[model samples]
Target: MKKDDNAFGVEEAADSPGFLLWQVTSLWQREIRKALEKYDLTHSQFVLLASTMWLMQQGEPVTQILLSAHSKIDPMTTSTVLRTLQTKGLLERKEHTTDTRAKTVALTTTGEKLARQAIKTVEQFDTDFFQALGSKLGDFNKKLRLLLQQ
Candidate 1:
């Protein structure tokens, strides 16, 4: 175990920001998985559903491309998940009124109800998960936003 055998730039693994981010993301996702379990929703499902709900609330016509963009999910995966949701009767996809080539997405009554409930559950989970950051959470979020902008 010679020190020269490794290519790490940091003296300690914990000193690497990317490694720390990966650790935190994994832990956070695990908790989110548990929180969403009661609703029988996968993380991707919850994210797409919630994003659709939000866009609808904003009076935006939710199309598959828009949903994919809003959720930061790849278009193909988004389409597949949406198809599963449609089969489960949680949402519906119809030909867009104005765009013949696109499909619009909307939550059914049941889906809307479920989304509201799941949002509350997830939000509570987030509050608990990030509680350790306390007053620094806002700054942390701003940093994340800055990273996203890049």
Candidate 2:
């Protein structure tokens, strides 16, 4: 008998971790996009904004480079997103007190309110999405963390 040959390989497509991960990620993104819609923010916008606000809550000024690193967002993309956030009056980038070449970021009052609300919405979506794993979610999260570390 000829060896089974399929476009994705002999193994079933659903058995491929990469393919399953991609499908899961796409589905999660779609859900997050919908969850964020009421706030008039895109998933990327919410990530950058929420990350920035959370960082500032640590009592330190946040910069574009720092936010980029913390959020794992590219520097150029971070800059563009920051500009968009600024236009929405959600955040402000002011000159760093000690660094003339750097700008520190802060959330406006409106930004803080929206960020908190958005955070709640996103968190609920995450809980609902992962609830299927039940108690096994912790193990699944650890596996994801290990993969990220690699």
Write the residue-wise lDDT of candidate 1 on 36-140 in tens digits. 999999999999989989999999789999999888899999999999989988999999999999999999999999999999999999999999999999999
In model 1, which residue pairs have backbone atoms overlapping below 3 Å? none
lDDT of 1 at 50: 96
Worst 10 residues of 1 by lDDT: 1-10
lDDT of 2 by residue, 76-130 (tens): 9998998999999999999999999888988899998999999999999999999
The 10 consecutive residues of candidate 2 with the worst lDDT sum are: 1-10
RMSD values for the candidates in order, in angstroms, are: 1.6, 1.7
Would you give me the overall lDDT of model 1? Answer: 0.94
- Supply the global lDDT for candidate 2: 0.90
Q: Which residue runs does candidate 2 get wrong by more than 4 Å?
A: 1-10
Distance from true position, residue 130, model 1, in Å? 0.3
In candidate 2, list every pair of residues with a backbone clash: none
Taking all chains together, each candidate's TM-score versus the true structure is 0.95, 0.92
